[model samples]
Target chain A: MAEASDEQLMLAYRDGDAGAFETLYARHRARLFRFVLRSIKSRASAEELYQDVWMRVIEARATYKPSARFTTWLYTIAHHRMVDHWRRAGLSVVSLDTVDPPAGDPGPQRHAEAREVLTRFAAALETLPPAQREAFLLHEEAGLTAAEIAAATGSNEEAAKSRLRYALAKLKSAVDDG
Target chain B: MADERDPKVSRRYRELGNEEPPPGLDESIVSAARRAAEHPHAPLVTPSGRHRWYFSLGAAAVIVLAVAVTYQMQQEQPDPFATGVSREAVKSPANGRARESAPPAADSSATARPEAATQAETSGRQGAAAPEARMRRDEAAARSLAKPMQAPAVETPQRMLERIVELRKQGKHEEAGQLLAEFKQRYPGYRIPENVVRP
Candidate 1:
């Protein structure tokens, strides 16, 4: 059961194998959490949206087709839920190229200079435009390719690639400056 | 499909730490999934797939109904030009031009005219009743001319109720009562409105 692919687990669940859902949820819970958390930057909202995404998966089990990778389907739901969240809040993603990156905390809890670089890196990530941040997070956290990122985000591959490239460049600069 | 992620960015991103959702959130989601799986409601369908089938079926039904209605209407109708046949010419036996034109009356019903029928009998004796074979075309045309062209609108239940209400307001008790009886007979199970039921 543990060795089963995500698609197989989802199919089993669709066919009324209750235990299959548990296995699938366990496999994705952490990465999906981090993905949602990083996208929203609000722990409360992220948790709520993350749970909603899974419930959507459950509700949509009757109609699920294994046409695409299960991960893409899962993240696409996450992406749409986040988009709805932003819409309800009357927020829009804006270009952050000109906005000055916020200062990093480099919390005293981290004793090493390397830990300070990690803190600065986290801060720089927060400053990126929502689109770029999402692309970067999907790439790093979900292990999605440029093509997969486009699939999840509903953007063209070129746009996804451009956003990820810009995100990597900005984060790299932040590390170098640290 | 290529891996475009930068190694340095990837390393730094990893160092940002793996933040997991709280235990409670995970439990709630997993419980929901299990419950749903155990008691499945129905399989989901893609909007495109479901709507395509429904739209296709609806469109096909509409087309078939339209064709049936058109064919039925056309069969019931006389040739529009049949009404244009000169009644004066059919009445006056001296109209040589009308007689010549009337022999080629295209519709079979055109022979139903009295004069045209007489011509049909004469031609039948000669076994050459080519166009003047109908015997009642003029009678049907005359009946059609006596009635109004447009059909009256079909009375729906709601419209019938409104008419009954109008009749009641006008104090035509006898007519309203008769119409109300007819309405009830037509719609055996319609719920009478409270206002219409009163008085």
Candidate 2:
């Protein structure tokens, strides 16, 4: 069961295997949580959106197809959920407008010495345009390539690569500044 | 091409540490999935199931349509006994007068006969007499229409010769002559009426 591919687990779950769903959930929970957490400004909203994404997966189990990688499929749901959240919050998803850094640090425990650099990176991530931040999160957290990122975010590979490049450049500069 | 990942940026991003959903959230989501999977019928329906539902509905609609069409066809054909009654009513002069007097009942009797008869039958002795009377009138009308007096009698040679004499009396000499010639051709062995010969 542990050696089963994500697609295999999803198919099993679709066929009424609850255990398979638990395994699949355990496998991607952390990365998906982090991806949603970094994409949005509010921890509460991110938590809600994250759970909604999984619920969508549950609701969609009957219709789940394995044409794409499970990670790409999962991130696609997360990406769309976040986009809906941004739209409801009246945030511009397409604009490259930078946002104010969220209040306090939005990260887990870190080494005392590395805390400053982590803070700088977290703040920089929050300030990035929504598309670039999503592109970066999909690439880093979901382990998706540019093409997978494009697929997840419903963008072309060129745009996805550009967003990821710009996001990495900004985060790099912010980290170096520290 | 522009899809390069910077090692320094990656390291810095990793330094921000991993953030996870709260344990409660995880439990909620996983349990929901398990509940859905375990029950199987509890959550979203499959496309195949939806198609089956549509098929069932469509089948039901077709069955209903067939029944309705059959019923309509049945209604369109005249009932033989009722057809006899309507024909007598139209043919007999006395029944036509009766129908004219009861215009509304006559107009709707073809469709409403069974209902009116049933109602009258169940309405006790007084009301029962009405349908009985209607039945009696219908029978009488049918008998009158079937009587020999109502039938046209076949004409005989004597009647033809008398008709020719009448035509000659009415100053139709040429027509009378044509009829005499035809009578002679048809009944050559019979003697002509003296009145026809005089004409």
Candidate 3:
């Protein structure tokens, strides 16, 4: 079958078609897993949270409503799950500011330049508050609108805009300093 | 150098700086989803068919018991005035005999003959008992009015299922899920079938 929309796949899954769920999982899993990994910083924890999120989805299948975009809804669940995991572990929230840039083996000069820029950018992203980082990621990586970000974060539109603006300014300053 | 100074620096960063996710993440999530789909924790403790029948029977039994108790109470306490009235009616003919023994008069006898005597006797008995009969009826009405009204039993599972379906149809899946969770908590044993959950 042609690729179905998230809403279509969810509805199909609700209607007892497991394959539709598989399709949805295939479409969203990598991005969701990455998103969780970035927020939580532990590969094993990310994997566990990933399983928990999908299990939540399954438990919630009977009651699924498509009020927001599917990915927005999915990310909200992931966000909450991460928050819960953080709380339970009694770990202090890590400031994104202190993240060291990943240093790989020296390669082509162009590749080296790109890596430096990326490393600086990652360090800058780590400096932002979780909410700001989330807003930025949703905007830059997921291509969500301010409205969608607000909905995902349960914040107002103005707040989402402010966070996005701050995130961009911080990234710009970090890159300049680097 | 000019590219770094460009106004679209933020946009460029976004385009070129996206992280590649770790491998095998998708496969793991899909595997988890498949496992959940296959082994959804539906307890087989109560069959729906038997549960519905039991509910119906319980409701029926309550209604039947209420009616039987009411009937037994009514039979045990017959209305005193009704019985008195019926007794008076049975004894009216005997009382009529004394009225019939009265001497006849020329002017009034023609009009006051047998009919007048019988009418007078019947009217006296009914007049004596009418106030008591009215009081009994009023008391019965007051008793009925004093009883509390019972709300109809809610269709617990079916209504919740329909609500979830309606919410899903409206694309409010998250809210629907919350409501269903609340419903499940409220009615712990009711298994919302897999078919209902799928859509």
Candidate 4:
């Protein structure tokens, strides 16, 4: 249940407990989906890659090990799948044009000013390079540390740190301009 | 790790993060996971499932190799009893034609003139038929193989039983009993009457 760690749940799934997999999926689904959604920036392609990541998890459950943090491995698979998607789609630059902004209302009756800032946040995210945005999302969404991000994305820790710094700086600048 | 006091940026990221994926996509993803867990070894409907064919291919290769080995051993030494061909004729082709024309069956005491028949006496193949039995077998084989259009029917166990019964009735109980013993050893699977076997 809630007391079990992600690794424990995954190990249980590996031993053929389907409920354990459902628990793991429920725990991480939102953050993982957001990671893929914001990384790819296209609802259609994001869903495609999102489903693919989970399928990879289920397929690899039998071989699951405790070698690394579960989140680290999950994000790593996500990162690699994104890389493959981009490679196949001819290296199209990751841009804000990928995900359409929310149509009319800023959700849940937040103040107009905060809504504008959130919109700017989404736009700024799309503007950043895919690598930078991914590092930021891995930190904020998956709650991975800089070292974990580097492990997931196959970059040095400093590089992951730099991307997060650049991403946060750009988003701050976008908000300040507003 | 930078600006710990930046509530505004953190708050804004949380707001955008609230943008949940569509419920339909969530349903599809979870359903797919359940399906995968249900059948871990089944290839997926996706592109990855194609890899399972390697298992089937390996099984097929083992089957083919086993069949090939069995067939080769059979060809190297066919069943002489089953084929009605003399072992000497099979082993020595130079004497094959002579064996083919000989009437050993017409006179079991006088075997075929094929040189291989003479060599049968000295041939040291273990488990081979005894010399006298082998000569009579050559005649039985010739009668069966050379006159295939009217090949004499092979002796049935019942016919052997009847002959043994006659021998017993003729006061040659030892010979009849010995032959009965041989018949019982050869036809263990046959359900013969115990009274007839002993009598």
DockQ per model, Cα: 0.34, 0.31, 0.16, 0.21
Which residue ranges in model 1 land beyond 4 Å of their true spot?
A90-112, B42-199
Best by TM-score: 2
Candidate 4 C-alpha lDDT tens digits along B1-199: 5432246566567656455667887677666666667777665444347667877888999999999999985665322323334455555545645765654321111222334444453453444756665664465456445554443224567766776777767877886776677777778888776645666
RMSD of 3: 27.3
Tens digits of lDDT, candidate 1, A22-137: 89988998999888877775567778888889889999888999998999999999999989998787333211221222236656654456666766787788888888989998
Where model 4 places Cα greater than 4 Å from the true spot, the runs are A90-116, B1-5, B46-199
* Clash count in backbone of candidate 3: 14
Residue B71 error, candidate 2, Å: 31
Q: lDDT by residue for model 3 over B13-79, one digit each (tens)?
A: 4433234344565555555556656666652122467587887899999999999999986765332
Taken over the whole model, the C-alpha lDDT of each candidate is 0.73, 0.72, 0.61, 0.70
lDDT accuracy of residue A175 in candidate 3: 74
What digit string (tens of lDDT, one per residue) describes model 2 on residues B1-199? 5447778888766655566678898888887887898887664333365587897899999999999999986665323224323333543546745654542221213333545334444554464456554664455445545542432223467767877898889988886887778778768998886778776
lDDT tens string, model 2, A1-178? Answer: 8899999999999998999999999999999987877676667777888888998999898899999999999999988888888879844321113222233565554343356666667777878888898888788778899999999989999998899989888988987897
Over the stretch B137-186, how does candidate 1's per-residue lDDT look in tens digits? 34434534553253422456887788678878988767677667777777
TM-score list, all predictions: 0.53, 0.54, 0.49, 0.54
Ten contiguous residues with the weakest lDDT in model 1 chain B = B103-112
Please write out the lDDT profile of model 3 over residues A24-122, one tens digit for every residue: 877776567556656666657767887778767876887899887888888778768877887887322223443333345556885667657666666
